[model samples]
Target: MSQLFSPLTLRGIQFNNRIVVSPMCQYASVDGFASDWHLVHLGSRAVGGAGLIIAEAAAISPEGRITPHDLGLWSDEHIPGLKRITNFLKANGSVPGIQLAHAGRKASHNRPWEGGKAIFPNEAEGWQTVAPSALSFAEGGPVPTALDDEGLHKIRYDFREAAERALEAGFRVVEIHAAHGYLLHQFLSPISNQRTDQYGGSFENRVRFLREIIDDVRAIWPTDFPLFVRISATDWTEGGWTPNDSVALSALLKEQGVDLIDCSSGGNVPHATIPVGPGYQVPFAEQIKREAGIPTGAVGLITSAEQAEEIIASGQADLVLLARESLRDPYFPLHAAHTLGDDRPWPVQYERAKPRG
Candidate 1:
């Protein structure tokens, strides 16, 4: 049997395989609700044989959305649309999951197809962005309203409410989005968190917001269900969040009931030169897993079946999450199984077309 196709259990939930559809933002939701686009986008991946399909970085609050088109779970009404998507995923043999995120100062932007500009609140299709510090991400981006203690509590409350809705939407796994220079990552890195309060100034303080959010979320999320945290294993810049910091954070998260760490890197700074290449981000996953003693998923530029097989075989990561590759070929796992001689079951409907094995 292929290691990638092998089932693995986390807490009381068992995944059918190790192939995960990495959360890729569709930037297609309307008012943060899942649309018909989401159903087909996510459902096809499940049909293509991914054991886990995580929805894109869904904002826990409207202000957390990266673009006006970003997916959201901030309100009760969002549950129905999400439930429609998750129900299909589960029916198609995938454990539906969601990544709850807040874009921080990066919020209120236009979608990538729309030039990806940061729109001002007064401008059409825009709202105010908020963050740990009052910072502007770009020259034209709005200066975020820094969160006071009261606002901080509300943010936490938003995450809790979002998690609850995710449960109602049939998500078995909830991965907290703390990577890619988002709100939580904004708080974790000293480079972005310039505050003098308990949420900044020191390493411990810089990570306080993430730790607090994890604790708050775990309080409401069920014990039987798995909780994962995705962290930027490195900011790829001097005086930024480092691999060592990720290891420490992973250890802490494990103690806080986090089952896995979805490891990725960079995006905290525009100036940082990331050495991008095939499997460019796998090393971070390896480092975090070995040192932190936590299970992790490796993503980024993982495009081929052979590449993914080696990643798991080499113990680089517990799971291989494909983003672009999965988009290009939703049946990546099926192709991979054939290429690796693992010979997994292709759907009965397509068995007649299976390569001669």
Candidate 2:
């Protein structure tokens, strides 16, 4: 059997294959509630035969949102809507997962369709953004308030509560969004985090906040359920978060019971010159897995069944996460099974459409 189609067991959960639906924001929600769009968007991927479908970054609090439309878990009311989607995903034979996120200084932005610009606090649909330091993501961007001690405590509490809600909503896998220049990434990158306190300076200090959050979430999250952390393995700039940092952090997260490291890179700075290409980020996943001795998920520009299969077969990463490619082909996994000559089963209703030899 192809490694790509082989089942992966993490904690007490077993994935039917190595293909995962990477979390991509739809920017289609109202008051942080999952709408029918989320149900169809996620459910279709489940139906596509992905072993795992991680829903887009769900804000831990209202202020943590990248946009007003970002899905949220800050309230009990959001549970039912998400639970509905989880049910569909489970029924469709995919493991439902969620990425809990706080966008930090990146918050209060207009959606991509609206030019993806920052919306200042005084503007409609905007609220004050917070971060490890009082800095703007880009020059002339809105300066976020540096999180105070009270703010830190509250944010930690929010993550814990959000994890609890994720369980209540029937999600079996929970990934902490520490990547792509979000709140936790803000603390991890010295370019973004310049604090003089215990939360900054040294590597240990920079990682403390994320460690605390892992502790907070794991305290409530079931032991049998897999917990993943998505991280920017490199900032792609000098003196910024590097692959070494990711390896070390992955080791620590492994010790903390994190089941996987979803390796992604960049997004911590505006001036970064990432060498983007097919499988450009796969090396990072390979390095981290080898050095940190933890399962890693390779993501970014991975669009082909052969490429994904090679990743798993070569031991570069334990899983392959698809983003834009999955968008273009919701049935990518099903089609990939055919491309790889693996007789992966199709949904009963769609079996007639399945190509035969």
lDDT scores for all predictions?
A: 0.90, 0.96
Q: What value of lDDT does candidate 1 attain over all alpha carbons?
A: 0.90
Task: Give a tens-digit lDDT track for model 1, residues 1-357.
Answer: 777778889998889889999999998888898999999999889888898999999899888999988899988999989899898998878999999999998888888988988899999878888898987766545899999999899999999999999999899999999999999999998878899998889888988888899999999899999999999999999999999999999999899899999999988787789999999999989998899899999999999888888888899999999999999998887788888888777778888989986
Q: How high is each candidate's TM-score?
A: 0.98, 0.99
Q: How far does residue 273 in candidate 2 sit from its true spot (Å)?
A: 0.3
Q: Which candidate is the best by TM-score?
A: 2
TM-score of 1: 0.98
lDDT of prediction 2: 0.96
Off by over 4 Å in 1: none
| Candidate 2 pairs with clashing backbones | none
